[model samples]
Target chain A: MHSSESSEVEVKDVKNAGMPRRELLRYFFAPKAIAVIGASATPGKIGYQILYNLKRRFKGDLFPVNPKQEEILELKCYPSIVDIPEEVDLAVISIPAKFVPEQVRLCGEKGVKAVIVIASGFGETGEEGKKLEEEMLRYALYYNLRIIGPNCHGIYNPRTGVDTPFIPERRMAKPEPGNLVLVSQSGAFLGALGDWVSQERIGVSNLIGIGNKVDVDETDLIDWFKDEEETGIIALYLESVKRGKEFIRVCRETSKKKPIIIFKAGRTESGARAATSHTGSIAGVDAIYDAAFKQSGVIRAESLEHMFDVIRAFQRQPLPKGDRVAIVSNGGGFGVVCADAIELNGLKVARFTEETYEYLRNRFPPHYGITNPIDLTGDGDKDDFKDAMEAVLKDENVDAVILGIIWQGVVLEDEVVEVLAKVVKKYDKPVLGSSPGGEFSSMMSEKFNRLGIPHYPIPERAIKALSAMVSYVRRREEFFRDEE
Target chain B: MSRILTEYEASKLLSEYRIPMIGGSLVNSVEEVARTASAIGYPVVMKVMSPDILHKSDAGCVKVGISDEKEAERAYEELLENARRYKADAKIQGILIQKMAEKGTETIIGVVKDEQFGHVLMFGLGGIFVEVLRDVSFRVTPINRRDALEMINEVKASKILYGARGRSASDVNSIVETLLKLSELVEEHPEIVELDINPFVVYEEGKGGIGLDALIRIE
Candidate 1:
C-alpha cells in the first residue's frame, strides 16, 4: 500500500512538474480508454445507459466488463477489469452498492488511474453504508485512484463527447458546445440544469455532478478549471463546501482568469437542516459563505434562474472596464427602471461627455431626452436605438450600456435585433439588452441570444447582468494587481 | 460549556498581550477600593467583580463618576449589596476600580469560536450603538493588519469613526493594532473559547484607544 501511494505521488509530481494543473484532471475528462466494470445487457439498467451514452458520441475506446454477458452493446465484455489485457485509464462502476467494494479493489489492482462510482446507497444511507463508503475511499487512496463520486449521475463534456451521466439523452436536455462548465453537487440539479441549458439554448463545455464528494471535492475541480483552456466561464451549484479554506483559495485564484458563478442552497435554518440530511454536509453560517465569495472573485447567483442570466451575460459580453452604465430605452418608464437598478446595484449612470451628448442630441428627435438613460421617445425606431446606442457607447466615460426595447411601442420591429446585435459587436465594452413583453419579445430575445447578444426580459435583470460584468472587471483587476 | 474569568484575570491576560487599558486594580474591600481609586485617579469607575455575573451594569453592580474617597467607599458597599441582591449564590471576588477613559467613539472587538470556521473576530460600533443598531462585521482569524483595518471599515456607520458630523476622527490605527494583538492572544491561548472587549474607547487620532471593559471565557 505504501509503495502504491508513494508511486502515485511520484507520478503526480512528474506529471505536474512545471505543467499547469489542468493535466491533473485530464484522464477524468479525456481518458484514452474507459472500462465499464458493471456493464449490463438489459436495456433498463443504469449500466446500459452509461455504456450507450458513451458510445453515442465519445471517440475513445470502451471496454464493458461483465462476468454474466459475453458481449454488451456489440463490444466484447471482460469478466472483470483484472481480466482486461491492457491498462484502463478510467473505470465507470455502476453495480449494486453491496458489490461495489470488490469491483473497486479489482479496478485498483488493474492500475486504473481514475474511476467514477455512479452507484447509490453509500454515505447518504445510515452508518453501515457510511462505513462501506469509508472503506471504498481507503482503497481508492491506498491504490491512488482518483474517485469522482459514490452516488452521482457522472459527467458530460460536450466538446470531447464524453457523456458519462446515467440519464438518457432524450430525457435530459443537452446544451450545445460552448465555453461554460458547470459543477453541481446534486445529481438531480445537474440533470435538471442540463435540460434548462438546452431549453434556454445556453452553450456548455462540461457538466459534472460531484455526488457526496467522498474523495474529490470542489477544490480539485476548481484547480482543474482554473487552467482548462476550453472552459471560459465556470458555474457551480453547491449545498455545502467540505474544505472551506481551500475552496476559497482556489476560487480566489481561478476567478481571476475566468468567471466562476455560483448558486449556493441551504441558507436558511430549515434549508440547512435539509442540506445536512441530503448530502451529509454541515451547512455552516451563510454569512461566512457570503464573505468568502466576496473575498474571492466568485460571483454568487441568488437562484438558478439568476445564475443562468449571469452566465449568459458573461458568455455573450466582455468584462466592462468600469461601473459606469449608460441606459438607452424607447420608453421613459423603462429608462427610469434601469436608472434606478444601475445605482441600486452599486453602479453609476454614465454622465456622457459634452461631445457624445451633442452627438446624441443631434441624432434623436428634438423632443427626445438626451440624459444618461438616452431616452428615445416612444415613436423611436430601430434606427433610433441604433443611433442612441452608438452615440452612448462612443463616450469613454460609459463602461457598459443596457438598452431597453419596450416591444409595446409601435415603431419597434423585429429588425431591432439585427441593428442592436451589430452595435453590440462593434463596441469592445459590454452592451446588454432588455425586451419585456409577450411572445414577440421572447422570440426576439432568442434571436438576440443567437446573434451573440444577451437580452433579459426585465429591465432590472438586464441591469443586474450588467452589474455582474462590472463587478467581475473590478474583481479581476484587484486579483491581478494583488498578484503583482 | 464555557469557563468564565473575572475582570482582574481577564485584564491581566489582556495586558500581557499588550492590549492598552486604563490603570486600575481589584480591591478586596471598600478601604482597598478607596486606596486603589485614589492611586489611579480622582474620577474612577468601580464594579462588583464576580465570575457568576455576566452583566455587572445590569445587576446594578457598576458605579461611575466616583470623584472622592467617601463616594468610593459608599459605591463599593452598594455594589456588594447589589451583587447579593442580584444573585444570592454569587461569589463576590471584590471591586474593580478603573480610571475613567476619556470620552470618544465606543467600539467593540470580540472573538468567538465557530464549529466549522474556527475563531471569528467581530468588530462593530459598541455601547448603545451596538445594542440599538446591531451593526457588526466578522472575519475569520488570524487576520493581518490589512484585514483588521478592513473589518473596521466594513461597518455601515464607520463614517462616524472617520470624524463624521463634525466629530474628530478616533484613533483607528490604535483599534487595528489592538485587534491584531487580540488575534495573536487568541492564537497563543487555545483554551480561550470566547473573548469580548466592549466599549473599547477610541480617543482622537494620535491618542491611543483603550479596552474599557473585557470578559474572557475559557473551555
Candidate 2:
C-alpha cells in the first residue's frame, strides 16, 4: 500500500547519485532501443542466439551490431554501438573477452544507459583474469556506465520480454509474468533454475544473474527492487555479500514492507572454497552472516529446493497472523508428522477453542479424533474436509491451517482442491496443503497451485513452509515495534 | 597479537565504563596486603597481580576466603610462590586484595572482534556450564538496552536467572546495563581487541551485581 511513497524516495536517491535510477533499470529491462553488439549470422553462435530470443516479444527498436553482415535477421547491422543512429539505452555485449574493453569504451562514448557484459574468462580464472577485470571496471566507472555482469547470463524480465540470457526460446521454458524477483550470483545456476521454473509454471517478474558484480552489486539492485510495485517478494541466491553493513540496513528497511528470503551458499569450509573459486568471492565467517541475517530479519532457506518451497508459499499465501497452526489431515500418520514439525519449528499446535472443538465434533463422525490435529479418518470426504476446515478457521485461537489430503480415500476426489481454496480465501488466512503420492498427487498439486494453494509433497515440508510464513509476520511485527 | 592488562588496570578500565567492580587495592608488600585486607573487612580474597598470568586460578595465583590479616599474608606468599613455580620468568607486580563477594549466580559477558562484522558481544551462563553447554547468544556491538535484554533471554539458562525453582531472580537489569555499557566502551576504544568478565556475580533483584574479575586485551 505504501509502495508509491517508497518508490518516490528511491527515485530521489537515484537522482542524488547522479544516475536516474528508475530510468537506468528500465533501460536494461524495458529499453526503448537495444544494441546487440557482436551480432552474429551463424545460427549456433552466442550472439545469434541472444538476438533470436529478443525478437520474440521485445516491442522495441533492435539494432544488430555486425561489421561483416549488412542485414542480419532482417535488421540493419552496425559495426559498433557508435554506429547506431537512435540513442541506445542498453547494449548486450557478447564478444570475445579481449575486445570487450574497447566496446565498453564506445558504449560509454555513446552514453548508453547500462551494459550487460555476457563474456567470460575474467576474474574466475586467475591473477591475469583478475587484472583484466579490474581494467574493465575502471572503464565502466570513468564513463559512468553501469554494468550487470562480465561473465554472467544477464537478466530475463518476462514482463518486458527482455531476454538477454543468450539461450534461445526453443531450448528454454518461459513462464508467465508474476510477482517474485530472483537475483542470483551464479549465472549457470540461474539458467537451470529458470528452466525448472518454466516447467513448474512458477511465474516471475524479474530474473537477474549478477556475475562478477564490479560496478553494480546486490545491494544496489535490492534498493531498486524495494519500491517496485510489481515485486511482491524478493529472493536471492548469494555466495557472498559485497557491502555487509548497507545490505543489512536496506534489508531491515525493505523486509518491513516486503518479506526477503535468502539462500546463502558457502555455509561450510568446502562449500566456501568452491564458491571462492566459482565467483571469486571471499565468503566470510558463516556465523557472522547468521548474526547479520537475524539482526535484519531476513528469512534463510536451507537449500535451493527449500528456497523454492518457501518462495511458493510466500507467493501463494498471505502472511500468517500468528504462530498457532491447526493441522487437519486424513491420514493419522501425517498429522503426527505435522505435529512434530510444528513444534520443531518453534510453532505451537494450537489447542482448538471449546466452541471450535464442539463444532468440529459435529462436522466429523464420532469415530474421528477431534483434537488439535482434527484427524478426519480415512473415510473423510470433501464435505468433511470443508466442514472441519471452516470450523477450525472460525476459531479465534487458530491463526493458520495445514490440511493433509491423502487422495487415496474412496470418497475424496479432485473437488477437494476447490473446496479448500474457497474456504482459505473466504477466511483470508493462510492454508497449506500436503498430498504425498505419485502421479495422482502431482496432478492434484498443479490443480492446487492454480487455486493459489501451496501444496507440499510431504506433511513436514508443508508445516515448515507454514512456519516460515508465521515467522515473517512475527519478525515484521518486531521491526514495526522497534520503529514505534 | 594481544597483550593482557593487569587486574588493577582492567578494573580501572571497567570503572571508566561505569561497570561496577568489587572494591580492591593493589598492595606491594605483605604488610600492605594485610592492612588492605583488614581495611576492606574479613573474609577477603587475594590474587597475584601480573600481566603474564592470564588464568590466575589455573596458575594457583588466586586465593580466596581469607578470614584475617595472617591468612591474607600467607595467601600473598603462596600466590607469589605459585606464580614463580608456574612461570619463573613471569613478572610479579604485587598482590590485589579484594572484599569477598556474596554467592550468586555466575555468568559471563565477553566480546570477540569478528573479522567481517566487527565487534560481537557474547553472553551466557558462567562457570562450567559455559564450557560444557556452550549456551550463549551473540549480537553486533553498539547494542541498546532492548538488544541487551534479548541477549540475556536468548540463552537457555536465562530461566535460571529469572528465579527458577522458587529461587529469587537475579538482577537481570544490571546485566543488561553492563552489556550496554560494555558496548559503548568497545565502540569508544578500537584498540580493545577482546574483553571478558567471567563469573559476573549477579545478586538478588534490587541489589546490583558486580564483576569479580575482568580481563582486557589490547592490540
Candidate 3:
C-alpha cells in the first residue's frame, strides 16, 4: 500500500514536503540498486548476513562498501560510498557505533538516497548514544536522507529481494518472501516465525525487525505498506507505538484499503513485561492501545504465532463477504470452543438453512448438533466431514465455514487436501481448520493451503482472521471510499 | 484550584500579558446602565455577568446591539428578569456593556490539557457544531507561529475561512495570530484555568479580528 522510503520522509520546512516522500516509497518494493556501507567481512556481523540475504533473495543490483576489505561475499567492496560506481537508491549501514556518523555523512556525499541503520547503542542506550543519533539524524535531515533505524534490526522486502539485517537470530534463518508483510517491533518474536512461515509455504511480502526506531517508526512503515499492490495482507507484532494518534489514524485508514492483522503482546501485566524485556518496548497503557485498536478496527492477534496463523489464512483464502461463520466439528467441545472464539472476536456463528440441515442429517447421524456449530457426533468419517462442510457452504446465510476436523483415526494428507481443495475452490468461501489431533495438524494446514483454504492453527486465529476480513470491508466503506 | 475570576480580574491579568479587552462598566441597575450607556456611547450591548451562568445567550441575559438609555434600561430589566427566572439562585453581579462590537465571521479558539499528553490548543469554527463536526486541529501548546497555523489548518472550516463556495474570505491570519497569543497567555498564566473567545468576530477584510465575547475561569 505504502512504501518504506516514504515513511522516512522529512516533513521539510516546505508545506508540500510529505507528498514527494510518499512517492519515494513506491521504489522500495523492487529497489533497482543498493549501496551497502560498513559492509564487513566479519562472520557474525549483521552486514555479512544482510549481504547474504540480499544477494540470495533479491535479483537486483548490489553494491558493497568496506574500507577494510577489497571484496565482501565476492562482491567488489568500495572504500567509501563516494566510490560506488552505480547510482544507488538505498543504503544499508552495519558498522561500529563510532563510524556510523561518518558513514552517514559519506552516504549523503555519494547521493545514495535512503539508509537503514542496523546498529545498536543509539537513543535507546542513554544520553551519549542519543546525542550521536541526533547528530546523524541532523545530517540525514540536512541531506534529505531518509533513515530507518539508529538502533534497530533491518527490513525485508520479499518481492524486491532487498534484505537488510538488524534482526539477531542468525542460524535458524530461512528466507521466504511471500505476499504477506509482517512488520514487528520485537525482533525475536518476528525472527522466530521466519522458519515456520517459509516451511509452511506461506507467502510473506515484507518482514521489518524494527528496534528503537530513531528516524522511521511503525507509522512510517504502515503508511508505506498500507497501499502496496503486492501485499495482500499486513501483520504486525507491536508492544508500543511511538505515535498513538497516527497509529490509530493509519490503521483505521489502511484497514479499509487492505486487511491488516496485528499481534499486540501487552494484554496482561506478565505478557506486557515479557514484551518490554524482549524488545525494550513498554506494553504502554493496555487499555489505551485496546481502545485505539477498537476505534481504528485493527484485528488484534492473541499470540505471536496466532498472528501468523490468521495471516496465513488470509494469504490463502479470499475474504468471506460477511461476518456469518459456519463451524463444522467432529467433536462437540471443539465446536463450542470455535463458537466462543467467534463471538469473542465480535462475529456471530451463522446458522445453516433447513435445506442445508436436512442435507447434513441425511449424510450424518441424527443426534448431531446443527444450529451454527454443526457437530458431527465424535464418531464420524470423511464422508460425514465432506457432507457437513458442503451443507454449511451451500447455506446462503453462512459467508464462511470453519472445519474442526478431529482426525480420530489415521488421516491421509494427500486425500484430505484433494477433497477440501475441491470444496474450497468450488464455493469460493474460506474454510478453516481446528484439528485437535497432533498427528493431523500439519497435514490439515498443508491441505488447507494447497486447496486455497485459509486454515488457522487454533480456533482463536480463525475467529481473529474472520473478524479482520469483515473489518476490512467495513473500514473500506467507512474511510477509504471515493469521497472523504 | 478552579477559581472563578470576575471580568475585571481577568482583564487585570490579561493586561500584563497584553490581551486586548473592550472598555466598559459593570452596572448594577437601569440607572447605572443609563449612566454607563451615556459614558460608553449611544449604541452598547449589556450581558449579564455571573460565574454560575456560562451560556448567557441561552439564559436570555445577552442583550446585543443596543441603542440609547430607554432601550438599554428595558434590555437590562428583561435580562435580569430572565436570569432570576432560570437559575433562581444565580446572582446578577451586574450588566457588562462595553460597546456593540463590530460583528463579522465566527471562529473558535481554545486549549485543553490532557493528563498524559499535556496542553493541546484547538482552533475551529465556533459554536454548537464544534463538538459535533470536530473540525479542529491540536498541537502540544505554548505554540509558535508554525504550530498556530497548523492548529488552524486542522479544521475543514479552514476552507470556509478561505471563502469556500463563493463566501468572502475571513481574516484567517488574524485568527491564527489571536490563537497563538492566547495560547502563550494561558500557558504563561496557569492561574487562568479555562478561556474561551467564541464567535470571535473576524472583522472586515484586512482589519484583524476582535474578541466579541470573553469568558475566563481562573485557579
Each candidate structure's TM-score, on Cα atoms with residue i matched to residue i, is: 0.90, 0.87, 0.65
Candidate 1 iRMSD, 1 decimal? 9.6
Give the worst 10-residue stretch by lDDT in candidate 2 chain A.
Answer: A274-283
Question: On a 0 to 1 TM-score scale, where does candidate 3 land against the true structure?
Answer: 0.65
Local lDDT at A112 for model 1: 76
Give the C-alpha interface root-mean-square deviation per candidate: 9.6, 10.4, 14.7
Q: In model 1, where do residues sit more than 4 Å from their true spots?
A: A1-24, A270-284, B28-32, B48-50, B59-61, B70-95, B127-129, B142-146, B183-192
Q: A327-374, model 2: which lDDT tens digit per residue?
A: 888888888888899999989999888898877766667889899888
Evaluation by DockQ, superior candidate among 1 and 2? 1
Deviation (Å) of A369 in candidate 3: 4.1
lDDT of 3 at A365: 63
Report the Cα lDDT for residue A460, model 2. 80
lDDT tens digits by residue: candidate 3, B1-219: 465555545555555655555647888867777888989997887888887777778888888778888999998889888989879999667888878777677776654433332334556676543656645555545555655765567567777777778878887778777777777786777565455555567755587776666666654
Best-matching candidate per TM-score: 1
Indicate whether candidate 1 or candidate 3 has the larger DockQ.
Answer: 1
Chain A TM-score of each candidate structure, as shown: 0.92, 0.92, 0.84
Question: Candidate 1 on A1-484: residue-level lDDT in tens?
Answer: 2111233433442322232223436778888889988898899899998998898878888999999999999999998898888768789999888888888778778777778999889999989778878888777765667778889977898877778888877799788998888999999999999989878788888999999887777878888888988899999999887766567778878978899899999777441321101011222377667656776678999888889999988988888889899988888888888889899999999999999988877777778989888778788888888888888888999999887887876777779889888888988998888889999888888888889888888878888878887888888887777667
